[model samples]
Structures are given as C-alpha cells and as structure tokens.
Target chain A: MSDKLPEKRKIKSAKKMRDIMTTYYLDAMTAKQNNRQVAWITSGGPVEPLVAMDIIPVYPENHGAMIGASKMGEDLCIKAEDMGYSSDLCSYARTDISCSIVKGGPLGGLPEPDMLICCNNICGTVLKWYEIQARYYNVPLFILDTPICHTQYSPEIARYVRTQMDEYIAFLETNTKKKFDYDKMARVGKLAYTAQLLWQKVLNTTAHKPSPMSAFDAFFFLALIVTLRGTQIAVDFYRQLLQEMEQRIQTGISMVPDEKYRLLWDNLPVWYRLKWLSEKFSGHNACLVADTYTSAWCGAIKYTDENNFLDSMAEAYTRIYLNIGVDQMADQVLDMIKFYDADGLVMHSNRSCKPYSFGQMDIMRIVREKTNIPVIMIEADMVDPRSFSQSQIETRIDAFMEIIKQRND
Target chain B: MNNKERGSIYAGIDIGSITAKAALIKDNRLLATHVILTGYDPINAGIKVFEALLKKAKISKKDVPAIVSTGYGRASVSFADKALTEIICHGTGAYFINPEIRGIIDVGGQDSKAILLNAKGQVENFAMNDKCAAGTGRFLEVMAKALEVELNQLGDFGLNADKPLKISSICTVFAESEVISMIAGQQKRENIIAGIHDSAAARVAILANKIKIKKPVMMTGGVAKNKGMVAALEKRLGLTLIVKDFAQENGAIGAAVLASKL
Candidate 1:
C-alpha cells in the first residue's frame, strides 16, 4: 500500500477484457456500452467496504457457488486435493476453482475479477481463492485482516482493518490515475447509506400483514446490494424498490397470499433440498415467512459518510457473519419471527455451515420458550447435496404442522 | 390362571424434538396410541402423551410390564425402563405392523429420516436429514398453516390440483419463495399444493433411493396422513406406499415392538 503508481495502468487493458467476457448475465436485460464495467463482489471476506471505493466489484464466491452446483466441484476439488488442499476444507473453495475454469456462469457468465480483496472474516479459503485468481490474472491483491473479537472487536483489529481499507483507496486512486476526493466519496457514502436505510426499511416492511417481501425476494436484493452497495445507482434502485414494496404493503398484497400458518426459518438453506421443502409445505398450505439469512443480510445498513466511515463501514460491513455470537444470532431470529407474524419456526440443522447452523437446538428451545411457537429442526447441508435426507425432514414437519393446526384451532 | 393368559403390557415412548408419541401393546396386539405436541419440554410432553394413552386405554401405568423410549430426546426421559434407538424401534414396529414392509420412511417434525429394513424389519441401512425441516413433518405443517387447513386435510387438497408445480429447491426458505413465485404466476392452489407434495416425495425418494427399496415402503410419521403427498409420491415412483393407520405414533409403537422382542 505504498504511494507508488505503476508506469502504465497494468490493469486498464485487463479490466476491459474482463468486462467484455462477463456481459452474459445481462441476458434479455438492457445492453450496455463499454462504459458499463462488470464487478465481482466476493462474499464473506472484504467485500462491502470495497463499495466505498469507486471500483466495480467482482465476487469470486458466487462463481465458486455456481461451480459447486455444476459438474466441476469434484473435478476442481481433485485438482486442489492434488495440490494438498485438504478435503475437510469447505467445498466452496473447490467450487471457486471450478468456476474459474468452467465457461458457464450466471449474469452472462461472471467477469474475471480485476482487483482481489481478501478478509479473514469468512475464513482462510477466501485467501487461497483470491491468491489463485491474483496469480492467474496478475493483479494487485489487498488483504484486510479483521481481527477476531471475543466480546467486542478489539481496537487493534479495527486499526488493522482501517489501515488496510486506507491502502485499498490509495491503490484505487493510483491505478485509476484519479486524485482521492474525500468529499465526493462522503457524498456517495451518504447516498449509499440512504440506499441501505431504504433496504432495511423494505425488509422491515414485512411487519405489514401479508408481507410484501419474502426471503426469496431478499436474496435477489442481496445480489443487487452486494454488487451495487456504494453507488448512487444503488440508492436510486433501492429507493424505487422500496417505493414498490410500500405500494404492495399499502394494498396488503402478500408475497405469498392466502397465508395460514407463518413460520420463521433458521440458518442457511440446503440448496439441493429447496425444491422438496417448498412443495411439501405448500402442498399443506404453509409458507416459510422469514429466515435468519434473509433478515440478517436484508438488514445490512450502509454508511454514507466517508470522512469517519471507518467505524460505520466496519460495523455494518463486518457484521454478525464477521462476528460470531450464537445468542445474538438467536435473538435476531426470534425478533424477526414476531416481526413477520409467523406462527411456527424452522431451524435447519445444517452439517456444512457450522458457523451458521450450530446452536440451532438451543436457539429452538429459546424461541419456543419465548414465543411459545412450535420449532421444527430439520437437518441438511449448505451446498453438498449428499447431506440432505428428505423423508425424515418431512416427518418432522408433519408433526410441527399438526401442532400449528391444533394451536390455531 | 391358565398358561395362555399371560399377555404382557408393553409401553413405548418415541420422544422426538417436535412431538412425543406413545404406544401400548398387550399380548402382541396394539391396545392404544397417542401423539401430542412436545410444546417446549420433551420430557413432560412424553409423560403427557403416555398418560393420555393410558387414559384412552382405561389402564394404569402399573399394569404395563415394561416401558421403552426412542428418538432424539429419548435418553432424556428418566422414567423409561429402557431406551432404544428410533432406528431399532422403527424397524421392529414397521415389521410388526406390516411384515412385507421393506423400507421405513419416518419423517418427524424437527427432522426427516429414511430407515431401510429387512424382512425381519431390522434396520439394515438408514439415512436421516435431522438438520432441516425442508422435507419433513414440519414442512407440511407450515404449508398447511399457510393454506388455513388442518394438517389432516393437506393430502386431500393436493390430490385435487389440476397441475403440479416443480419446486426447484429443498431449502425451506427458498421453497417459501418458490411458492410465492408460483402463487404470483396465478397458479391454482391445488396444483401448488400438489407440487408441494411432490417436493416432499422427492426428498423421501432421495433417502429411499439410497438403499435397495425392494417393495412396500412403510411411510410413517405425521406426514403419512396426507393422502395427497403419499399418492403423488406413489405415482411418481410407480410404486404404492403402505401408510399405517396411526403413522404419527409409529415410532413409539416401534419402540414397544422392540421392547417385546427384548
């Protein structure tokens, strides 16, 4: 992070090449000129803060996730394993590698990451994932060390992240040959925060009877927000989106209408198991009204002031996902259930996502005690299709539904 | 007393996370069964279900020769004379109920499980999804609640769907979203319901597919009562499902059957 600029923008040509490559996801959508560059905003690591900087984001994790679902997970995993990457490491790592190799991807096939940022928040897999990309297409890699906190984040960790974030801006300025404008960024930060506030407001809109938003819709919003958090366009986009939801709420239009039993879902979904989950309950006329992930990510607040944006960005950017606390997680989920007017609860006992799925039983008990709501614990994994069993989960759901109906009666 | 008059009364408690079910067997014949909500406390729920069963049978706990327990919270019940795995109990119970049953699909509220049994109804291979409610009793409960229908009526609604939806994801969160999308598309409620039933059937098919599903899949747990889901599943696999009359209490009955064997 020295104040040295390369003789020629080493990445200028490379960024253009990557944009030309990634224009696939804009399928059936608006076509853009070369002025519209694609960005990859990597998940779990130093991503949200990068928006504060004026570079388009490119997330490598989403690419990896796509690879994980395709035929490439085992192949990439074998390659990584051959290189001594342990099998015990998350499959997401292998999936990212596969994504790099596979020609197939979402959003017109994702663009190759221009600048890579790695944070310790999601874990070491990201460091390795970014390292592979940085070497593959030579680029500047910035690593942000989010010091783990016990009770509250130690100031030292905050200092470390602040220093890294400062260097990131310097790198962007030098590479772009643009002078750092604190005022412009601060204005953008304020705009970004407004967008975030609107997004949060949209999520809170579920408080309306027959919520205008659903967890599925939130995932889409997350996709947009993650990619466009710090931009004015994002603020406008969210403002319009919130307005639409406001209309829905005003009209009492339910995302899924004819609501009978409302339920709060916990933890990450078993991706391979989603089809079965929807049909089983929808067949029975039940809808999962809310979940921990949608609520948590949907509530992400943006900090718009760049002058002292360090604390706000750090707090919002490195949220509960960055800070692991089971009790805090449980409380947030419990609060969301009531907010959604949910009648029951679902806790996914995922084997893959231990960081998210652990303490599910304890959380279930607490939710039941506090809300007197029926809590159903179903087992599955985040990505690995092998970990899910459909029948046992159905049996458990059947019992929970009976309780709901009985209670309603 | 005559030598043929000795018919031991056996009680089995299946203390699952979502529900506590109890079964009473006298002289190898089913006497009574009860299934009740776990409500916050599994142990107390187990006791309540057991008391309710005894009351239904008009008999005291003293008359029972032995009591056994099974399920996630089975070990927590101090009153049970012995504890058995839900696996062992389910196999025994399925075999006793229908000797032709080769597979036991026991879906509970908190979890969903697939247990493979031999001719003897002993567990040979088993797979369980105790991690999520995507394909279990809890899933159906949510859907039924959404429909404003009783749990008992879910199967009927599913059967009437003129078209069935293909729910693409198994995660409950995504499933709900998928349902919303289907509803947004102005799909029929019955078709949506049928589609949901297929989703559960597909999940069960995954577990049942793992091992050799010879014949006569004994679909149990609260989900078995849904004729829509079970029938839809039957049409999908081109095989008939043997749903027990009191599938909700099968786990506890399985435990009692295992107790009788022990």
Candidate 2:
C-alpha cells in the first residue's frame, strides 16, 4: 500500500488563488486610501449589488476562517468573552468582533466598513452579530430577512424576500449617494452564476473513484466563491480549478493515496485541524470525497437563473442549505452520499455554527436508515481549537474506519 | 509457562488517567495481569506495569513480539509497537471475553462511553461523555469524598438505601456541593451515595440510549468494579450488564489480543 501511494501533486491553481486573494485583501485594506467604500457582508448575503456599486465586499466570516486556520481563534475568542460577548456566540462572530478592536488577526483585522449587509438566511445569530458590529463600527446596515423554507418556496415567501431585496438596493443607494446600476448588476449576477456552476462542476469531479481532490481542498478553494462570487476573477479561477481537477482525473492522480474508502463530511470543518483530519483520513486510505458544507456554495444553484439573476436571487439565497428544514437537509445529504458513492458519513457537530450543526443528528439518522451506511458524529468547534480533543477524535476516526473496513471487506 | 509458550507472548498496556493496567497473553490465554496507580507520569506507569507483568510471567522482555497500548495515556508509551484508542480496544477486549457481547459501556476514571458492536466484533457505533467528569468514576470519587465514605464502601452502602435522594446537578463540581448540602440537611449516607450513583448512571445511560445500544452489553473499565455503578447503570439501561472478573483490565487485555494478531 505504501508503494502505491500517489506522488504529491500540487494544484497549480492554488498559487494563482493566493495571488488573487492577496490582491482582494490588499484592495480592501487600502479602500479608504483609494476613496473606495467597503461593505462588510455575511458569506451568504447578496454581494453582486455591492460589486455593481463598486463597493468592495469584505467578509468577516472569511476573516474568521483565516483567524482559525492561523490558530489565532482562541485569543480573539477569549478577547470577545472578556468584552462581555458570550463565549457561546459563534467563534466567527467572536473573532471578528474582537479582532476589529484588537487588530489581532493575520491581516491585522479587516478594514472598517462603510456599511454592513446582514442576512438572516444563514442563521439567526448573524442578525444579532451584525447588529452588534454595526453599532460598534457606526455603519449603515442592510438586513435581508429570508424566512426559513421548510418545504417549498411559496410566492408569499418570494414576495417578502424580494421586497427586502429592493429595500437592500435602496439602502445601498442611500449609502453610496449614487444611482443603482442595473446593467452592472446583471453582469455581476451572471458572473456569480457561472462561478457557482463551475464550483459545482469542480466538486462533482470528486465523484470519480480515487477522487482527484478532497473536501480539504474545497474548503481552501471555497474562499473565492464566498468572497468574490460575483466577480470575473472568481469565475475564471474556478474554471481553471475545474480544468486542473479534470486533468488530475485523466492522469489517475488521487488525493487519498490508496482511496479504498470514501466518506462524506457534514457541517463546518474543524478549521484548526483541517490538515490533521485530512491526514488522519488519508492514513486510513480513506478520502473525504465530498462535503455538505462546501457544496453549499452551489447547493442552491438550481434556483439560480443566469439571465434573470436579480429576480431569481431571492429564491437562490433564501433556500440555501442552512435556511432549509432538517428533512430537506437530510435529503440533500442522502443525495450526496449516493452521488459520491460514499461508504460512511462524518458529521462535525460544530459548537460555533448552530444552524449547520443543529440538524446533523437527524441527517445522520436519516442517512443511516436510508443507506444503512455508518455515520460518525464528532463534537468540535470550527474555529476554536480549544473545543477539540485530539485523542477523542482520533479514537472515533480510527474506530469509524475500522467499521468501514469491516463492512467493505 | 513453558519457554516455548512464553516465546509467543503478547503484552497490552492501558495507561488510564488514574490507573495503569497491563495484561499478558500467551497462546490465546491470559498469562498474567497487573494494575497500579498511574501517578503523575503515565510513561513510568506503563513501563512499571509492563515490567511487573513480565516478571510475574517469569519471561524476558525480548520474549514478547508485540506490545499494544490503549487509554488516554496511550501515546505516552513510546515503547509500544502500536497505540489504539480505548474505544476499539474496549470493544475488542469485550468481544474477546464474551463473543455474545453486542455493546460495551465503559466508564473509566475521567470519561464514560457506550460502544455498539456488530456480529463480526467490529465497533459499529459509539457515544462518549463530553469533556466532563459527570458520568465517570471521578464523579463517584468526588461524591464519596463529600459523603465522608471510602470509595470501596460506596457500592455496599448504596445497596442498603431505602430511598435514594435525587441528584440533579450534571456538573461534577455542582453535584459535589449538592451532595454536601444534602449531608448538611441530614440526608442518610446510603441514600446520598445511591443518589450519586443514580445520577452518574443516568448520564451514562443517555450515551447508551443515544446510540441505540444493543443487547448483551458488557461493562468494562475501572468504574465497573463498583457494584453500585453497575447496578445503577443496569437499572437505567434496563439490561443486565456482563461484568467479567477482569472488567477493569479489559482494554489492556484487548490491546494484548490485538498485539497477538499484529
């Protein structure tokens, strides 16, 4: 098995991605100097309008991921707790809030916001989190309330969210003191749709045996889609990434060296332990072929219309994976398991993200009952390494792999 | 043991938080076992227990071909050929002792868990206590200290309780204070001990029920020696637990068994 280990192949797109992201962050950092406006937006919030208005969109959630990946989450989280923010708040929220005051994250904190975009489509916590940040930063705020779509996207729900979308545009205009640009938004929305499709295609490439890439790679590549979704750069980067994946598939290059077992991940990753978790699974000759978390960028793509981007944006954003009911979440998870030919499911019961982690147990049970494949639930915080227990998770992974091996054999 | 039989010996060492246990197996038979306080250093404890077992079996260290370590301190044993998680070790150990065991409920010094096993003896599913000592032996130790009773006496005293008091605090520190207040309120020692056992058992049972634990469950780990805990867990789970004489050494025994295969 060791002899059959695939040679380490670096994705050529990673270097380019770094350059693009560096440029993006640098632009945000110097936005004030350049007389450009910066709008802090939730990861799931509509960024096309902001892009169309020439307002550079910044994601505190993305910054939180950076803080976590750099292992600076604990200090920022502690700082938030010291400032009377509950430790129970999302680590991303805690880090963002604390990092803003301390200038403590990797990039010495995000640039100040001219306005804030709060979307309740991701979770209810974001509403309060954004409100607190808005108060602190003294920025104009736009709140997009997308009701939970339990079963279907009703017309009433559409009308309610669409009204908010119009209000969102007006709010943007008020802050910018300029007329809204419909043509630019149309182009931006089309670019966002293309990027989402390309991302979905890149992820689908893992459906092949001995997957060309793993969810760890997706977690890294996910930054572009979240931060610059409505930009030509994101679409072009993903197109190159998808091509790279296609080339890997053609060359029989595999992420998991042996790739005897394939597992699907659910929920936000333990950001601090991404490499450890990846290697742990790879050591067992198992590849995390797909994940519900990363696929979320493209999960609602079916609702998106490239041509009618603004009109369809309401449904596409509202019916995202986090905003849907547990049953729908389970259905999507089951579909991924079948689509990826997964042998087991590994669910992270994240302590930070409640909306993503809350329905995991039901999803786990649903997948097990429907597919009879084993599901492993690990309790962890996506950002805060303090919440993770290396020994305990190691044991769970080893035992889970043992079970998978037994059934496969 | 004959020299030829001893040459095939495999050793398993389990360095738990409180105690270090070692088991030696030769020709698929339990040759010798040792248990000792792990103290502040697990590495020394692993070496002491392993060396002690080797002397008791009257064999040289070179006679053993493989050594497997388990438990929380498993990684500290640098001499171990392989280290396995206590979950797999416990399940493997339990199944080796009783082939019919479909589940394992292990309550060690600091942690408690329920492990479900398939017919092939592989671990199917498991649930563990959070990063707390509420459902573990440490919880009982704290209760015993609060009750002013010996740890070993807790089992018999609880068995004599007419009506056990209710312990509602899930946090170990709070539960200790609750027990102290109950003593101040003139609660019977037996009743308080029984209440403590009941609460701990109830917490452990949640783990079992969470995973839909299977039947013929075997109880292992240091806490299993306390008859009161086993009884309380059995009552909560409504299943008779299979407790072997070497229940506390089960993980070590399983480690030794795996070493044999290695």
Candidate 3:
C-alpha cells in the first residue's frame, strides 16, 4: 500500500483554504493587470481593495500568520519577543517569519513587492507591521495615515491624508515606471462605488421575509469585492449577485430557504471554525440575517461629481469597520436589527483579535437596553482554529437562542 | 516504603498553545500517553485528554492518583486535580528529560512563552510573548497557507533553506504581503524557508537570552519537533538540543507527574 493517501478534509475547511488562496490569487491578478512593476498590500482588509484597483497587491500578513497559528510562531516570534514585543504581539507577524524559512514561504505564494502601503485605521499594529515588511522585504513603505478618526474624519485630517496620497501616487508612479491615469482611477473608483452600493442594496434586501443571502454568501461576497475590486468580471459578478438577491427579496424567498429566527452577527468570525458555527446556528432555526462586517462594506462612501477622490479614499480607509469603538458598533448592529428585522445578536469575543473584541459586554448591554434584542458572545478567533471551542460556542448559541425564544414568547 | 512500597503513579499533563499532552508513569515503567488539541474549549479538551489517557491505559480515573494541567490555558482546566503553570511544568519536565536541562522555551497557539529554571528545574524567572498571536501555534497555521504545506513539514523545509531571505511581516497581517512578495519574486522556496525559521528562532532566542540561555539547552513544544526550527536554533545558539518524541505533550505529562507528588 502506498503511504500517499487522499487529504482528509471537512469540506468547509477546504473551502476556507480555497477562499484564502483565491483571495491571494485575486490580489496577484490585480498586480498583473495594472502592468505595475511592484505592488504591496496587507492580508486582511487592505488586499481586497487593492485587488479591485487592478494593481497587484501583496499581503504581508499571510507569511507569519500560519506560524503563530500552528504552535510555531514562538520560534519566529522570538526576535521581537526578545525585544520585549511580548507574546501578546500579533501572531501574524511571528509566523510571517516562520513561513519565510519553515519551507515553502512567501516564495511559495506571491512575489516580492516594489512598494508597501498600509493603513492605520484597522489597528495601531499596522505601522510596526509595515515597518517590518519594509525592512524584511526591502521595499519603500507608505502609510495611509487616516489619523485616529474620533467620531468621523475631520476636514483637516482628510486634507492631511490627501497630501500623503499625492506623495504616495508619485511614489507609486516612480516605482511602477508607469503614468497614473486619472481616467482609469476615476472609472475604477466608480465601478467600485457601484459594487459597494449594490452590496448595500443587497444587504437592505435582506429585510424581506428571509434575507436574500446567507452569511456564506456574504463571506464569498467579501472576498470577491475585496480581492477583485478593480476587475470588470468581479464587478459584473457582484452585480449579478445583487440581481439574484433582489429577485429573492421580490419573490419573498429566504436565504436559508427556511424562515428561522432572523439574527444579527457581529465582529470578525472564527475563520477556521466558521462552518461549524454557521452549521450549529442553522440547526437551531437561527439564520444570521446581517453581520456588521458585511454591512460595513455596504455603506462605503464613493466620491464622484463633488466629492474629492483622495478625500473619499482617505475617508474610506479611516472609516473601516473596527476603527470605531463599542457604542458605534452597537449602533451598527441596531441598524441591522431594524433593517433585517432580526430577533437576536451573536457577538464573537475573539481572544486572538482583542481590538475588535472590546466593549462587547457594553455593546451587549446596550443592544439589550435599546432594542430589547437577545445577544450572545461566542468566544472564538477569526483565523486560528484552536481558539474555537465548538462545544462552548455551541452551548452558548443554544442558550442564547433559548433566551431569544423565551423573550419572543 | 510507605506509598513507594505500594507503588506510586505519576501523571503529567502539558496544556500547550495548540495541543494538550499527558503521560503516566507507574514507578519506573512508562504506562501510556496521548496528544489532543486544546481546541476552543480548553476545559473540554483537557478533560477529554484525561478520559483518553484512562481509556488508553485501561486504568480508572481513580487509579491516576493525581493529575496536573499546565500551558497557556492551564488555569482553565477544571478536571485537573491540580494546575501547575507551563513554566513550572516545562522547567521541571526539561530537567527530568535531561538532568542538565536549564531553560525551556515553549510556544503555543496564541502565545510564545519561555521558562527559565535553576539547576533543579525550579523556575527562577520567565518571559512570555502573549499579547499577540504572533510567534505562537496560530502563526504556523496561518503561514502554512502561504507556504501551502502541512505544519509538521516546517522542520524539513527549514533544513532545506539555503538562501535565507529576511521575512518582514512580524505581524501576521503584513506578513501575508511579505510572503506574497516572496512568491512573486520567484525566490527559491528553501531560501524563504530558512529566513522564516531563523526569524522565528530569533524570537525564541530572545526569550532564551532574557533568561540567559544555559548549556545543554532542551526545547519542548510542537515546534521542537520541526527539524527546521531545531536545526535553526542549533545553528543560531551553537548548542544541540534534546527534543523529546512528545515534545508538545511534555507539559501535560509533566503536569500529571506533578499531580502524583501532591
């Protein structure tokens, strides 16, 4: 008998891996199409938009992430660990190094970048992270500094970013040895804006009987738009997706195909354990009608006639989902409840990503206080599988549903 | 001649970042052992390991005498008769594995922690990298996707690393870009592999230095099994390490052994 055997997969895990890699491929395609000599991007949030830009964007997060998740981040995590970076530093950074040498690393994924662009909106960690990538990959790093947006982007801060953009565009042009076509930029921006508007419309469509789409649909939608932001096919696919969803809404069709307890999901999902969560939630007649992550993309601001493109871009980067703190996060979910006619909320208090995990207790309190909605906190991770205790999350969801049922009754 | 006359059983449980490990020793003879992921529910995973060890050894939970839990999630294990921090377990276990063992660096799913022990395996002090998931078990899981390989293959990959390229993404998010760039550069996979392991080793070595790494260094963790990491550490530190077969499980085994003493 041969030692070689079929790879054991729990279908969804395979899908997740595909999604992750597809995300990589889409970003690579963006670079290839732009005919740019170099492009740099981060893995989670930034890569998606860059992909839509038709410029090849590289994600530094993928490199060290696996090492941290696989009990190996420590080895790679040691250098910063030695410098007093603390074990609590992001695992992606640790494993990014791990992937570099632990065989088949970034060399195994995408190409070296000519330019690096990171935004400060997501977390304070980005500046340091990009700095690392700049040194390690030897690329000129650019910061899309949307100064800590308190409430919203002030005009002054917006202008500051616009100035940076001017420099950044110049740097990008020099690096690519290509001219910056304003027409192309404007066209791509409009297409992206259209995609955003449709996605918002599709999300709004969920208010009908059953949501016109499932969380699974939204997850795929995120990848397509985020990773393929700049392509016509990507835009068309989303437009088609919106049309299908609109039809479902008009026809009174449900995304789950069954009218269950309409619910709201909040925070980054336990990426590795999403299927288990979705399956577990689905079994209880509870379908997630809206997640803040999906909704966050729906309302993306677009600049056209009167709006300055750079200002709009600056606002978009600063106004990311996790940028705002708890009260705003609660308000977003509250809006979803009314829009999706949701019955309850599920909040994932991820141990790995603590920034997103903040004020959930307060958010839960407020949600209960404001709309009288039932809220449950599922302790899990967006990427790492170990943080997901299926039983714990399952039990919590079951209990949360019972609470909802009792409340509804 | 008291409990020794009747025969004593020592069980060690090492709760790790990614997996929980256990070992049972009846006097001098090794009884049985097992490894299981801590999963999302550390309590459940720990208890499951407990049940597994009993079933595997064909001994009732009562016969185990005492059990101990140690690791990132050590405090969360309710089933353990007692809980010892991974620092204590790793130091003690390292000493037991080798009488000369002085420092133990252990990494797990969401944390990278190093333990320093006196000659007697008692912890003098320790340093841990915990705030972020970098330099932990989760790091490997995320990086494997970029490398497109199994976590276990990290050792072989690092060993093959010839052209060590410096990896920049210490934060997992940016690292993705770093890896993607490496891939696009058409660089050899082995060179990138060396860069990753060496950088990871640098992280652990930093912790070693904080404790002031001593001779006859022994490393135990899931990473200890990776040929690339061990080899890289050997090259970096200029000392050979004694890695146990169940390096990852050593904490659990150590915990169990500590349980019997209590």
Best by the TM-score measure: 2
- Per-residue CA lDDT of candidate 1, range A1-409, in tens? 1102232212122343234324534421232344433334456543444454455566655554445444344555566567676665566665555445554434333555556677666555566667887887677777766654435656776676677777867766665566767666666666656666777776777667665655545544555455555666667666777777777666556655455777777776555455567666655557676677754443445322445554466655555443556676677777787678888887777554555665676777678678877676776656555555654565566546745664675
How would you encode candidate 3's per-residue C-alpha lDDT over A1-409 as one tens digit per residue?
1111212111122354355556656556455465654465653333333433345655555433433333444445565455555556665654454444344432454455777887776667777877876897787887777676557668887788778767777766676566777666766666666667766776666677756566655754565455455556556666666676666556565645455688888776555455666776676767787787766664445432213444467667666667765666777777778877888888777665666777787887788778866666666555445555653344346546644653564
Worst 10 residues of 1 chain A by lDDT: A1-10
Off by over 4 Å in 3: A1-36, A43-54, A60-87, A91-95, A103-107, A249-253, A302-308, B1-262
The CAPRI quality class of candidate 2 comes to medium
Sort order, DockQ high to low: 2, 1, 3
Q: What TM-scores does chain A show, candidate by candidate in order? A: 0.79, 0.98, 0.81
Question: Which of candidates 2 and 3 is the stronger one according to DockQ?
Answer: 2
Question: For every model shown, what is its TM-score relative to the native structure?
Answer: 0.56, 0.96, 0.54
**Would candidate 3 be rated incorrect, acceptable, medium or high by CAPRI criteria?**
incorrect
Error of 1 at A307 (Å): 7.5
TM-score of 2: 0.96
TM-score of 1: 0.56
Cα lDDT computed for each candidate against the true fold = 0.66, 0.91, 0.64
Native-vs-model 2 lDDT? 0.91
